[model samples]
Target chain A: MLLVAPAALYVLVFQIVPVVYGLILSFTEYTPLQRGAPTFVGLQNYAALVGDADFRGALWVTARYTLQVLPVTIAIALVLALLANRSFRGVGIFRSALYVPHIVSLTAVSMIWLWMYSQNGLINDILGTFNLSPQHWLNEPSSALNGVSVMRIWKALGSNMVLLLAGLQTIPKNLYEAASIDGAGRWHLFRHVTLPGLRPMLIYVIATDIIYLSQSFAEIFVLTSGGPLRSTTTVNYLIYTEAFEYSNMGSASAMAFVLFAFIAALTLIALRGGRER
Target chain B: MDRNERHTVYPANRRTFLKTSTAVLGSSLLVSACGGPSGGGSGADGDLTVWWPGVNPTEQDFVTEVLIPAFTEKTGRGAQATFIDWPDMSTRLNAGFSSGTGPDVYGHGPAAVADLVQYGRVEPLDDNLDQLDESDRKDLQTGLESGLVDDVHYLYPIASTGRQVAYNAEHFTDAGLDPDTPPTTFVSLREAAEQLAVHKSGKLQRAGIVFSAEAVGMQQAFTSILWAHGGEMFSEDGTSVLFTSDEGVEALTWYASLYQGDAPVDDNLGGTWDGLPPAQSPLATGDTSMTFTDPATLKQIMDAAPELDLRFMDVLAFDEGDEPAAFGGAATGLMINPDSQMQDDAWEFLKLTGSKDYNSMYAQEVGIVPVRASAIDTDYVKASPAMASAVANSEAFRSNPNIPAWTKIRDTLAQYLEQALNGQGTPKEALDAAAAEIEPILAEGR
Candidate 1:
């Protein structure tokens, strides 16, 4: 009890208290200026949330992003891990190279992507070789989501691959050897052993990715700024715009709670479906 | 499988106990990081603390060399100034306000005053400012009226910014246009752009002009015209949305057409048209032949590319039939943190910054125009012709309506302008939608 007491207290103060405060704020006209008092309005903020087109649009975008980024990140990571897991010359160098962007600052990575995705930038300059007309990467709404998504995939894939690589190493080589003696092919070995072994780590990685991506603010802040008419506005960016920039902290806090609930629920549902054993 | 993960998990070879201990230490450090003053008393021993944000390296040097030494000599008080990043400054100020240990004075934007006043963090200078000269007081009145909350002043003017057309003299010479007389009106600017605009081997090198999503809300080169064209961005009480007028729609449409054929949106995009460096300032990149930019950026172009030749032009009106008006506002001001230890010293510093001596000093060192009209005619500005014209035009400068919800309205209008520029919505549709978003914010303010 003594050992767990400190860790539990930390969570209770930092994590749970903030979440509870946000929940209370969601039901009130919670101005930061009027710190002591807030006019409670029940679930009016949540009701108001439904009426906000920007919120709805953000929800739609986040939903689409989750579907697109999840499978792609996992697939690419697994493939890279397969190639990486085997002994090869200069494999260590390749391994570090894959993980470089993952360890890079989000601001730095976002700025580099902002430059790459900019018109007259790296992407356009490359496309010029194929006689492709330069597209307005971050500027236009039609292509804005895809532009942001591409950056997200590139940013996220490395970590997912690293996790899968770790999980791949955990699977016993003796199992593969026995399977091979039984005349099992690589696909059969992977299906029987690697799939089951990596399930728990895969569940953790996927849940974390959903939670982080749903609350994505850094890339959106740097690149599109929820713009080209807010084609890139995420729930987290909405919370920022509402709170800090506009000082509508009550509404911002309300939106934050809604987002927290959604992300938590999504993560739970996602993890629940994975291998619990 | 990983040595790095091993290092991360057990820095000193302890397991769960270690990780938990590190987390405990981290939070404890965060506490000490936030707690106040190690230096004993209320700084009554003649220490003046100031909060500043980053700019050019020269600015850091200016604070160290000029402002501090001069201020210390005048007051005989030791001034300690701390520089923070701009974004971090906001959070720091917020924390300071909440904690009651904020700096004596803060270098903040004018836009910050409205909210800061509301939070009761900033003190109104209406009474504290009565001691300054009438001319100085008048300038602060004209300049800081927009930063008022409940009809009381919260900020003193320190610098000014406006949208004036800056032209590349070389582009003008190369395109066979008059290098001295760049366009003053929209039509003339468009014609010049058509002539001067150049695209290269699948790359755009230069453009005639640039437009931004803030064109309608800010309209520095165009705001006065936005007002005169029978379109006001806000109501008189500072409580209602007003820019959905037919005139406002017409204004946006007119601005949009400038980019449609004569200029590509790509040409006018951020940094591309500013002639900035790798980040792409539209003017700096030579993407735009002319730009409606702040004169402050002129120094940037000179430093960035010494060979680059850019000229300044005033904004033209809505039409040849109408009078032209330029948008104008001061950059930021110094304010009294209500929670500051030394109220008398804070007031003294504020007065000194606005005094002719320090005004001229700020102008010379910072290259910003003084708030007072009389300060505009100084011999210093006369030495430079561009400075002379801008100083003279400072009289015609007007501020945004002192509205409570103006910030949110600005965001709404920005999104609307981008929509109108992209043809996603008609100018009318965009204006109506933006007005709709602002209506509630104004209503809530009421």
Candidate 2:
């Protein structure tokens, strides 16, 4: 009890307390610049968001981003895991090379992607070689989110691959040998033995990806700044604008809770679907 | 390993982990709750701290090398100077002001004055103004006017920024337009731009001119035109949106016209003002013939491409008959924290920044326009043709409204402006939408 006390208290004071305080703040009209204490305007902040076009647009954008990034990342990650799982020459080097981007700071990664997506960047230079016109990658509203999704998928692939690889190792080799003896093909063995065994890891990956993708902010900030006409504005980015840029803390807190609820709901649905599968 | 074997190795279930964590947390809270806050006081420490948003390495070097040393020598008091980037300055200042921990003195753009005043974080400069001599007062009058909130000045003017229509002289000569004389009206400007433009296939290889849609919602590029047409962003009371009026709509329509004509620009495809480094700017790279630029940008262009022939002229007018208008004022000024305990020392240091000698040196070394009228006429200010024209155009300078909600209002307008430019909506519809969005924000403030 004494050994655990310090660690538990730190989480309670720092993490849990701030979350509860943020919840209370959503019920008030809070501006840090205002001299007086926050005026309680219960449900007013949430009600205003219902009529706010920007808030609705941000919610749609966040959902679109999640749909675009989550599945693609998992799919690519699974393929990489399968490739890396085999006993091949210099496989350790291959695994380490794949994991390099994951170790780099997200901000640095975003900046590198920002440069790559520039009009005259390496991406366009390669496209030019194919006699294709350079596309406005981050500047235009239509393709900005797609550009960010590509970068995000690339960044997330490593972690998902590692997790899936661990799950792959956990599957007993006896099952594969037994299937081979029964005259079952690779497809049949994988369908019956491998997938069921990987169900728990798949659920964890899908649920966590949904949560993180819905909370996207840094990429949008570095790339589009929610512009070329707010096409990349996610709910989290909008919350930052409301709180820091506009100093509307109450409204920002309300938006945060809405996002939290959204992520929680999606995560629950994903887990339930995974279980059913 | 099998599930039963794994369970034997790891006995801690989720339920047990939660129970143990709760027990530990409950006991820990009781022990830690007895402690109190570690710091004291609502005022500043004896030593003074000054913050200035640094533009470049030279600016930072000037502050650390020249300003701090001079202040320490003159006042015999220890002082520290911090150079923050422009984008991060507001966030840092807001946090500092909210927590009563802001620097004793700091410099910021005029647009931030209203927020500082509203938060009661700045000290009024009435006493400082009263102490100044007649000539000193007269010289600072225009610059100081921007710092006033209900006739009480909260900032001491140090430097100002004014916009100019900067053109590539080589491009002008190539297009058969006179290099010495630049366009002074909208029609002539576009005509000149058309002649200078180069299109390759469906893409613009080089634009004739560019209207930058960069920071502060493209106001730096559009405000001069808006003012030329006698448009204001807000009403006198700062309680209502006014840029949705007839003048504003016409100005925006004319501004958007440049995007599709012979002088066609595609800001969406990325151009001069894409927040790239100065070396990659359209003007520097010969991608644009003309742009509405400031002194800092002019300096950057000169630094990046020394061989390029550049010329500066006053911002274009609505018509030949209309007077040239530019967005200018004390763009950056120094203000004292209201809660500063070392108020007198901070004031003494701040006064040095506003002095004519200091400003003249600042203009010479740092390439910023001095706020003091006396300093504006110096040889250094005159040598830079752009700064000289900016000074000449200072009389017509108009600024954004000083209101707490101005940042929000500006952002809203920028979004709609982009929509109109992108053909998503008509200029009237865009402005109307902006008005609709801003009205509620303004009303909330009221």
User: Which candidate achieves the best DockQ against the true structure?
Assistant: 2
Q: Quote the positional error of residue A131 for candidate 2 in Å.
A: 3.1
Fnat (0 to 1) per candidate: 0.12, 0.28
User: Could you give candidate 1's per-residue lDDT for residues A184-268 as a string of tens digits?
Assistant: 9978988988888889888988899998889889888787777666777888888887877676666888888778778888898
Compute the DockQ of candidate 1: 0.13
TM-score of every candidate relative to the true structure: 0.86, 0.90
Runs in model 2 with CA error above 4 Å?
B1-45, B55-58, B215-217, B260-263, B267-274, B363-367, B373-392
lDDT of 2 at A23: 85
> Per-model C-alpha lDDT, please?
0.69, 0.78
Q: Compared with the true structure, what per-residue lDDT tens digits does model 1 show for residues B1-446?
A: 49878667645545665576557655653443343332111356668887876565666777778777887888888777878776666666755654455788887776566666655667788887676677666765556664666778888777765556677888889878888877766656667777876777644556667655432333342345575465677777777667777777777776666555444523544222221142266566565677666666654564566567766676465566666556665666788776566778777877777777777777777666556666656886765444555666664556665555556766767777666766666878977887777788778766
Model 1 Cα displacement at B390 (Å)?
3.5
Best TM-score among the predictions, by candidate number: 2
